[model samples]
Target chain A: MNIHAIKAIYRFEMARTGRTLFQSIVSPVISTSLYFVVFGAAIGSRIAEVDGVSYGAFIVPGLIMLSLLTQSVSNASFGIYFPRFTGTIYEVLSAPVSYLEIVIAYVGAAATKAIIVGLIILATAALFVPLEIQHPGWMLLFLLLTAVTFSLLGFIIGIWADNFEKLQFVPMLIITPLAFLGGSFYSISMLPPFWQKVTLFNPVVYLISGFRWSFYGQADVGVGVSLAMTLLFLGLCLAVIWWIFRTGYRLKS
Target chain B: MAPILSISDLSKTYDTGFQALKTVSLEIEKGEIFALLGPNGAGKTTLISIVCGIVNASSGTVTVDGNDIVRDYRAARSLIGLVPQELTTDAFESVWATVSFSRGLFGKPKAPEIVEKVLRDLSLWDKKDSKLVTLSGGMKRRVLIAKALAHEPRVLFLDEPTAGVDVELRRDMWRVIRELRDTGVTIILTTHYIEEAEEMADRVGVINKGEIVLVEEKAELMRKLGRKQLALHLAVPLAAVPDGLSAHNLELSDDGEELIYTYDTTGERTGITTLLQDLNATGIRFRDLQTRQSSLEEIFVNLVRTPS
Candidate 1:
């Protein structure tokens, strides 16, 4: 838990996240521009505004969160998975550095990359479509909290995965589709009441809702509910990662 | 002085129900090159792995410099560095960075000069900037050694350190090992190469089928357990051996050109002269004679061939 150890581990891990910087900086910018073209100009003409703001402006926060979640998970998973693949986990397990130091270092680096990507998407969204933040401070807080929560979730995925395919399988197939269905591109209120209730069960809805609330002063869910859900998710992820480290799961064996 | 490492009745049963180690016990002095010899399925690597704390012991205890390995893991691990059988290193990392990072992993403050010296000692300074994937197999092996030595461990374990390398690299590795030993480091090596143990070890322990069959001083072990062979060049090619020469217990070469006699050197009386005279009385004569000693490999084979 010493700062020196954390610095070394963190430095090494961040240096290894090549795809994070590439995907984080490029994916969001590209995806946000495309979303502006397809959903803003093409689709916006067909549908009316949802919450007093333009439809293009409505999807900005959700698009940013999309990139944030995927980049966060991919960065953290690859960071831990490479060591296991290369047999360097033996070196880590045998080292004097504690498990908490390792968790903090990796999760922190992933969060840093995720946050940077989030900011870039937010800035890029302005170039294509005009966007404004109603609660700037809460927006920053929500962005940071979501990044940390997803980064920790990625750490758990990294530890549990044995192969490269398995690493991508969960994030790409499960998490992304769930987030998309949770109303990243459209509002869930447009669906039947049964589906609306079901959307509430999706953890990503709270993250997207919280991020959307940051901009335009409008939110589908209560601001308190979204913040509380994010904090709860972050706590759950930290608990899982801590338990894995404590039991030395997949690490010692 | 107390022994540097002690293990009491250590055993390990893997999850698959394969017993890798069976109630093994030994004490290694602080500055000796102890070689553990065994065939492919033996418990040599298992024992070393347990001591290095990579694998847990099913039962029994291990202590390094008076610290229990399980109870004082960090202290004990910091005292030992293991060069694994596999040639694993950071494929993209420069040799200098890899070795220095290994030192940092042990919680040691950065010491670039010492790291440089260790690299230079291993003849890797020239390749310090080269990526590990660019290095040859032998060079990669040396990198593994440099990384293990970066922390300056008190006890170093080389587990089959030279498995597939060529003769030149193997010799160079031995040279470095000797230099390390001279500096008062305890070395415990596991190898299937009997010649390696014969050339370098101060003492040898043979493990077979999850058991330590024998442990003894190299010279004394050879002297006490080894057999000598006497071969006689025949004066004339014999169609068959005479019945009277049977008491000498001689074996005829397949070509019928030589007679082979085997005896124990440790015996007070070899009876070679008596056998020669008896052969002469039986109308046999030899143009020349030769004697040979059994090698460590032969003795190793004999030891493993014995029943439990």
Candidate 2:
């Protein structure tokens, strides 16, 4: 409801991201570029094609998703964790802003940053391998949804964590591994049948599959299912956040 | 005029079963400076935290200008600006940006001129472009005050605003606090420095062990604190105070079982030795005596006891 307050918090967070461009934007961009080089160039050269697309191009969407997920989590988690770490959250807590507006500002800024990083990485990938968007609209949709969704997850992680170590814990321990196992480097179909079924249980598989579908008209699962799973995760994070503000969990008291 | 902030039967019990606040009740009038005085672990912060909505109360309620702190939190909170005891700031942001952003957080429209005015008011305008992390501790404290004032609320709560600052900064902070009060903002501050309360407050509340032991006009609190009570156990149960001892400031107990002496603890002499000699001469003997400094009776004694 307080649009001005949201904008204030939003611009401030975005400014912080700008001040630490190296840590916030550049580091992730560079790391994803490394993934493109090692996995796309060296590894893809050994394999001629998968699903009728060059291996280098095949991993493009997946690699972008990897950085998107991690960057969203890190940007959002640190955005909030730093305030809690420094004890500046009392300002926002005592202000006229509502819990919903606070979430909108923080999560919105983080998602925007992650999406920007995703777009820049997409640009960098174009330098290495030829790329195409079979469905440009869907590509943007997948990118926006994933950024917003993961940023929400990151917001939850931030509120849940009290220490810097814990802030980094979820992104490092849980999300990174999930993305690696979720077909960010290879299609899940390439796995053995039993392994493929086990990999299906990983929620991130839907995101990458739907995203890759938007890229090259290929996917390990239906696009609808991917969209559904993403929305489901988004809803779950929203519910948890609502409960957090209601109970004042980790934030109010 | 109605009270600006009213708290009734507020209490807080930590998960560890430590009762930090027990049924605290207080009313802060509009435009008056009120001071809350208590020692460590005395629930001073707890009470402030609850009223600011940082710490949820386990019982009772708080209302700011008739808006319930819990039921109508936005209305209640929008009226309050808090300078927390801890020195916390946006470390990477410029002083002006942080203060302006705090104003926006209170849903106020952006006014760069007002932001500049707040910065200048705190003498932070020169450092407006400086990153917060680069500023000294005193400067950072000033930024925190600026941020709290950026909202320009009807009431201001300063929790230990000068706890660790130097004397000069403390004086500057007092000036700022008084200026805020002069503008018709109700001010409530907590401090270990009795002199600050003595110098600034119109009303003073003393909290101890999670309870408000006394709340009165500053003058009354100071007046009550001017003396100590020494109870003398008597060897003989006299029918009345010895006529000879009437001039020595002594009162015989109802049954003459003890002699109660009231004396200014701050006087050049307590006159105890002379009183004892007079008692000996008056044929009045005492078996035992004890000096007590209860909350209401010895507030000044404790004030003078503080190392300043």
Question: Highest lDDT among the candidates is held by which one?
Answer: 2
Candidate 2 lDDT tens digits, B42-130: 89999988888788899998999999998898899889999999888877889988998988988889889888888898999999999
lDDT of 1 by residue, B1-308 (tens): 89999989999998789998889999999999999999998988888888876677889999999989888877887888889888888787788878877887776778889899889888999999999999999999999999889888999999999988899889989999999999999999999899999999999999999999999999999998889999999989877778988887889998898999999999889989899889879888889999999999999999999986
Cα lDDT for residue A240, candidate 2: 93
TM-score of chain A of each: 0.94, 0.98
* Segments of candidate 1 deviating more than 4 angstroms: A2-5, A18-28, A40-47, A131-137, A246-248, B239-241
Instruction: Grade the docking of candidate 1.
Output: acceptable
Model 2 lDDT tens row, A121-199? 9999999999999999999999999999999999999999988899889999999999999998788888999999999
Candidate 2: regions farther than 4 A off: B228-308
Candidate 2: lDDT of B251? 81
Hey, what RMSD does candidate 2 come out at? 6.7
Best model number under TM-score: 1
Residue clash pairs of candidate 2: none
